[model samples]
Target: MNADNITSDTRSELPQNSSADAAGEKTLKKVANRLIPYMFSLYILSYLDRINVSFAGLQMYTDLKMTDEAFGFGLAIFFIGYFLFGAPGNLAMEKLGARKWISAIMVVWGAITMALALANSIHSFYVLRFFLGAAEAGFFPGMILYLTYWFPERQRGVAVAKFMAAIPAAGVLGGLISSKILEMGGIMGLPGWKWLFLITGFPSVLMGIVTLFFLTDKPESAKWLTDEEKAWLKGEVEKDRLKAAAAKDSVKLFSRETTGSLVLLSLLYFSLTLGMYGFQLWLPKIIKGFGGLSDGQTALVTVLPAIFQALGMIFIAKSAERTGERKLHVATSAFIAAAGFVLTSLIDNPWLSLVTLSITAFGIWGTVGPFWSLGTSILPARIKAAGIGFVNSTGNLGGFVGPYIVGAIKQSTGSFHYGLYTMAASLIFAGLLSFFSERLLKKGTRIET
Candidate 1:
């Protein structure tokens, strides 16, 4: 055909293309509406269960007469089991399917969390925390992999954002509820921290049973979706797979490029986790250090950072999806978080410090969506399960290190300044590392047309 004839023909097909796009959009909205809220709730519970010890630490440490170092060690031990079992747990989920594996994981961890209330010695605390980590190891990465089944790369950022927003939401809910629960100390001869665990742990077990029936593993199996919608969704996801395959011929898990990318991504995540747990686990204590504040008041103030962080992350992830930019978003957020941490350490005014801490929380937690989206985008389909596991598992060691080092610093130095500075330094390194990640992975990735 002549050039003008071809152009005319293409123009004639535009209406059909537009109609198909509209239908696809509607289907995606339906899937997201059905899945995201439920998944979000699961994550919120997961996070609350993971971090509730921060609230409990208010009295638990005193009740046990544990030193700062011992308490920090107890908190850090969870990640040890988390690191060891993380990859295997993800692989188990891959073998068994999300519904069964995730449910089992929730039941196990929920039970362990409740058992934590029975801890009367530091050694018992250590063992329970470690087991808790092992039980919860695969859940986060499993959810990330699950999202890949439903959302294509273009929409994955926002999907991850919505799911991860639960982190901050958990903080808000955990803080409010845990504060009240802590006030119930000595009722029924049990401390309020004991109540916190008993109350929070039950819902996880209930939800685990609910998940078996509620979740569909893949769109093809989703009876709620029409055949056409299922086909369209699968086609979109396949396009992403094809694009990734085309970029790099090798899908070897241990190849130099793949291995290097894994290390870089792990380091990046390590920095984030360090900042996250360092700040989050210690936040209640930090606020109380401001003096003249009750545990309830401190918990209330802690929620402010989470609220701001939730809003910030959602906004940033939406913007990244709209712009189709990932690396810069991750880099910028890390830098912002690092700066906020540094500023927070320098400032003495409690209100101003809280504002800076909110900014820090915004940066630290905000990196979640774009960072994981970028990491997953770089990995080929063959290695996704192993790659995500390695990244999440190794990276979470920072979770152990962060709280430990912070506790060590607090015990020896009698201040949180050095600890905050250490966190700031880690975040700065992560910010710098994002550029290197772009160089390493960007060449192998192309935006889908």
Candidate 2:
């Protein structure tokens, strides 16, 4: 065809193309609505069961006669199992299907969490924590991979943010409920901490059963979706896969760029987890230090920061999606969190400290959605699951290090100030690394397109 004829033909195709895009978006919205609620519920239960130990530590340490170091070691050991099993677990999920694997993981982890109540000796505590980590290893990364099946890149940031908001939601709910559960101490002659474990653990088991029936492995397999919707979703996914494949010819499973991206992402996540877990595990104790507050009062105080964090995360994720920007969002949030930590440490007033810490919570937790979006955006479909697993697993090692270091500092120094300073520094480093990693990836690397 002549050049003018071809141009005329292409112009005529624009309306049809625009209409198809709109229909695809509508289908995606329906899928997101169907999926996100159930996923969010499962995650809330998962996070609650995993971190309830922070609340349990208040009474369990005294009851078990365990030292700070011992408790810290027990907390840290969970990530060892998490790291070891994470990649393999994700690969297994890719092979076995998300429905079966996610359900199985929840059941096993729930059982382990419940069994934590029976831990009388420090050794038993350590063993149970490790197994808990192993059981829960792939759930988060697997979910991240699973979301890619239903949502295209354009919609993923908001979807991820909505689902991840469950973390902060769990925090708020766990705090409120745990305080009441703790009051149930001596009921049927069981300790409060034991009750906490038992109460929190049961939901996962129930949810796992629900997951078996409710969760579909992929859009192609979803009976609830219309054929048109399925076709559109699948086409979008295939386009992403092809784009990734085209970006790098013969992309190895572990290329230099892949490894570099993994390392940088891991470091970024490590700093985030360090601040996250350290702040969460220590918040109740820190509140108690303000003096004369009952356990219930302390728990109530702890909820404020989580509420702020949930709001911040959702807002930030939406902003990132609207702007189509990732790295700056992640870096800015991390820097805000770093500043919050520093301010918290410097402040003397108890209420002001809590407020500053709330800002810190907002920054660290807020980064989760955009950061994951950034990480997943750069990976090819072939290695996306494994890459996510590597980042999450290695990053979780910070969970171990953060809590343990804080506990050790508390024991030796008689103050949490040093630990707070350390967390602040880690976050600052994370922010800087996040910004530079984007530049590094953009220059002759497949990680940024």
Candidate 3:
């Protein structure tokens, strides 16, 4: 169907009662107002904990007497645990409930993160990082699945955009905080890098405790919502579920179409993540390479790209929602990011390199909302949790590959140019695949949303 037809069909499904529509809007606002803040906070902390190691690596590499490859392996190993546990962890969340499962994951990961401070050797660092990955494996996909319970298809893009904005928020805030924290060396005879992990990991524990009481698993269990509001929300969700069931011939865990979609989505995510982590983990070092900059100066410079990235993510997601188009938004973002990566590699000027890096950050980060919306929108409700888990787990393998490849190439070639070029190619491939995947999905499954 055409865009106009899709919009019209969507409109036809809306409630006829203006008063009810207003009431529903108010209820949704209330739900979002209550839920989004806590979720956003939790995600920021989660992201910070996961990536603070990059900042720590600025000094910890020399402190622990580690090589570039060893540090890269440490970064990559976290994803191994993440990849292994993703699907099962998500399924466990489905069985055990989000409140309990998410809180548990947070608490355990928080402890593991704190313990990272005590690591005095490369082996211990690897072990701690691996466990940290295992502890935090399902949190992202689990949160995605959790949002599906609260928001319908039409609203999910905005909801997810706001939530995922935490990525860049973590980057900006975490960078600033980590820079200062790194200045705390010899405060207690411990290095600033040790203090970085020690301080950042505690919030997750507190947030986990807050989540236990603050979050509700489903709309039905939320006491803040009235009976009328609950009924309206649940009714709307039920309509989506029934529609998904009716649209698919079978909602099995593994079907040909579903599996194909998952694999494509995985590759798409792999490419994007390669750029995301490669930039994130190495940006500080990249900035430092320009010379004549302190660690604090490098950290502050990293904040600009994240700020722009957050803006790009929110703007692109809102546009995707306004246009009711997912595939093109994702493809275009990837293409823009690919160009940015390519340019960053070729540019010789430091200022120009920073601008290009910002563009790369914008493109890779911008893809998050529309990409998830596209994946989740077409997934069968029956297997959404598991399917999302599978896609996330498989895709995150890129997290491992991205840093490792960059490190390996940097070591071998003695320059980051080759790594940036490789990531650009990956992004270009992803953009092309996303463009073609839209047509394939439309032809094969009659996907509308």
Candidate 4:
């Protein structure tokens, strides 16, 4: 059956035949090609802006005469605003639509990031970081929710993964570029960290403006898609929603099972996030501690883990999609991450440490797609927005805790070993919790992949 033979006028009468199935596959590919690269690029900019502070700290901490504890506090405060606003911000996206709300988010956060270059005191650092978190609150979870509006349940793991591959991509790119930017301290009489902020922040603002014109809100409104493709894609998504609705035992927002699943997922994400940010936010400094390495050398070393992470995450998610499983993948990845963390803490050889960090990055990031796939499936549609928001917001508290604890431990003990051990324990807990979480989720309500 030739997909091209399908026409708009015959759309309704076109049976659920092989031709339509082929058309749907082609349509999904078209959507992926059209959206994913652009979405991937946007996320790269978004994550680069968020994590560049890790690199900037090498210079900024010294210039400002800040303690490790104080610097960690500044990093942790961003998540406070992020936690407070995540749910509300997601709800706002639901009302205002992704196009407007996401654009606004990017613009505000970009401006705050640029403003970070002006920080002269710890007080200013704390204030700007908090506002930066508040400004960027819903962008990540909002992108997750936004993907749901396009892709069906089975396809989300790959879609979410491809989008999230940006995290490591950002890490890799930010390291390479930021390392050079840090070398530019005397350029225009401003320090290198200031240059890093200015360079990284401006692209987001430009991309935010582009998003207003570039992004299509939903398939029904996508002009590039033929009416036949649009109808078929929308029908596919609606079928998934209908199946979810029919299978749900209770449609209520606050059902006991629903609430329980949300809580458990939140905790699971908390552990995963703690390990993620703990490693990511401290990676450059961790490498710098190896001795005799310059900032550029430290940044280059940091890129290796991110490269492994980028490759591992995409491959893991794609494999999970093929196997049509999410739970075990997440648990397995978490366990691997725990092992990596433990090994990294114990290793003294710099090269061996880098190898372990790569393993750690691979394992921690490999869980992202499967985790989100499992999460959205467990939560009922009625509570999805708020449920994801609650999970992400509460879970992100770990971001604060991870960096702060690692910093404080480094301050008191003068080593990251205990901090790495703490993160490993949390990952193990997350791995164990995944099995229990699957049990707590309602049997029928879960969207079958």
Candidate 5:
């Protein structure tokens, strides 16, 4: 509970840099270097696992002859289970700690994903989605819990942004992997979709196992941190906690403040995700509109945005870390994403459309790093896990709404344009919300909590 207990300083005495800025910078670089890779890997693979279904969606649609509603319901069902566990999962991450809880969640979800290879009908898909959602429920929240253990208040935006670099990164990885799997679909008495499910699920199993040994729950738990650094961090955080509480404004992670963050985040996330999720679900089909690429080419093209996204994430995360602020990074990223969506919706030229799409991917992925960091920063460690859990679980509703909404729009209008416009609007709303949120936060409202 004491901040002194959680410091990562390298000395028995705190650094005497004579300036807070210098010491904080050293800590930022040190922590970022140490944790970024592991965080990045975990995030990329975890996200890949979550959205692998989208990659498989095209094939599944063909094999199952899924109606628009049927597919949407199935996609949305994942979040139903995801939402149910929001509070519990984060609390579990906090009480049980990330190492054990996350490992268990990974194993369960991986195994569940592996089981998807057996799905035979819509009924089976629905069942699998429910279980998959339940299994995957805690992973995101577990990540938030994990981060609060390592990052300080000022550094949180960049710290979280780095971890979140995986969203679009997943897109790239998913596309490549999906393409390969699609290629392998007919080789071993299975369809490409089957291969996608099997290959994607296997990583969850492998990563879950790897993380047990590799990941630490907190800096305090790291044998690497110096005693003085640990003490100083503890003192620093506790100082803030006391100040917050004495001001009758305790920043507990699961309080009303956090709920406020969850609301704005979920709303913003919903709109952004609408564009993202719908885009992912129907992208191959949209590319098919170009009428030039083969199914394989379509899948491959789908992967390019992910690469742009990964690069964007890395750039913005490091930038935010250096700047020690999130507003500009987040707002800009959101706006960029919105622009990309708009371009894709309006541009009739294929190359230009794809380029715009990739740019949007860059923005979305770039902004996500800061989005989550901003979400977690206002809260304290105790409920940090749960707060983020609530955020992710709720935000996933956008995931549910996106694909279905897109499909419905497409079906009704007989063009992807309507659906695309719907998605763009979502992105714009999210951007505006982020702008307002930043302003509110600067005034100490924590409205974006």
Candidate 6:
């Protein structure tokens, strides 16, 4: 029953899957019941912290006398830090494990987010955004690695899907809250933008508390499980990881193979991100472009896509789950989004365009998480953290580039059509890569080659 004996016994049984009776299966049961929810709560908060800027951007631009380019650059600068520090931060997660490390990260970064209310100039925006990116870099990848320990190859997709849903869900919460907070336009010398930052950022204290109480880095360490239960849990995980390892040559956070795929995916993802982030970072701006929506209406409208996106995530992900197919869902979403972008560009009609955009939001951004789930299938279990981090962090370069890309195009041309078209390729590329990657996985016995 000792921890050492439990781990060794678990490792010894790595290749075996002995059927345990209900009583003997407590370990897997506990993980299923406990760890996923715990991680997800923190994930939701972490994501909210990182993206709170977009909601603030709705008002920040006008108040500070900042231009679209200034907003775009400030948004893009977040990724410069992501690019510079993401890989190293993710590597540290692998070495240090997720519990205490992510605990420290969540607390510090939450404080940083709350600090955003203090920004007075473009200089402040640039600095805060970068450090925020650095603070947030390892989260998604670290979580990806964390998930692999709990679920084997078969279940990892759905597990990841649930977490990925948080992105759109964040939009849902941000939209709902910012609409109310915007009414506080003249509270004690603080702008609505400042309130948005302060209130949203302050919740990390609660999130950090939950993390310290609940987050588990590995199965054997789960106090919720009995020693016998822990052994079985650890055994199942080690076996799955070893099998995944056998499927690839290496699984380091920055492995060459993962980096290669990450590069291609990032370029493609950048384009995809351009469309998604451009819209997210500028949804309020876009809605305002339609004329006469009023502040509250715009806030409500901004959340519409994310709401649709959450539903779209379920519907599309279900189809993927049923068919066990990744490409068609992704492709369909991308093409529909492309069509939405075109309609929004050409139309003078607000109602028609907003409807199209609603579909576009859910259809396009909704598919992102599921597509990421598809990427997990191709990863060997050993390097899942590094592989996903490389993919996510590198792909985020698009997030960094996206707002700027569209903002520049919109500023120069007085329209978003050119930028939309430029980003359209991202949708196409991700689908193509996913389609081919599936083919490659099927034809070969191993995923690493």
The better candidate by lDDT, 2 or 3, is: 3
**Candidate no. 1 TM-score:** 0.85
- Tens-place lDDT per residue, model 3, 336-396, is 8889988988888888889998998888877877776677666655665456656666777
What is candidate 5's local distance difference test score?
0.69
Clash pairs of candidate 2? none
Give the candidates in order of TM-score, highest first.
3, 4, 2, 1, 6, 5
Error of 5 at 196 (Å): 0.9
Which candidate comes out best when scored by TM-score? 3
Candidates' TM-scores? Answer: 0.85, 0.86, 0.87, 0.86, 0.78, 0.84
Candidate 6 global CA lDDT score? 0.67
The TM-score, computed over Cα atoms with residue i paired to residue i, of candidate 4 is 0.86
Superposed Cα deviation of residue 394, candidate 5 (Å) = 3.4
**Pairs clashing within candidate 1:** none
Model 2 C-alpha lDDT per residue in residues 221-272, reported as the tens digit of each score: 9999899888888988787667666744546658765777777777888887
Counted clashes in each candidate structure: 0, 0, 0, 1, 12, 2
Question: Could you give the C-alpha RMSD of every candidate to the true structure, in order shown?
Answer: 7.6, 7.5, 4.6, 6.3, 6.1, 6.2
| Candidate 5 lDDT tens digits, 1-449 | 00000111011233356665566556656767877788788767667777787768767787988876677677767767777775688788888778888888888888888788888899999999888888777776567556656665555545554465566667777877677677776776888888888888888888889888877777677666677666655666566456545644444544554556556766766666666667666677777677787566778888777688778767876676666666567778878877887778788899999999888778876766566556555544556544554555556677778877777766677777877677777877777887788464435664232
**Two-way TM-score contest, 2 vs 3, winner:** 3
lDDT of each: 0.80, 0.78, 0.79, 0.80, 0.69, 0.67
Q: Say which prediction, candidate 1 or candidate 2, comes out ahead on TM-score.
A: 2
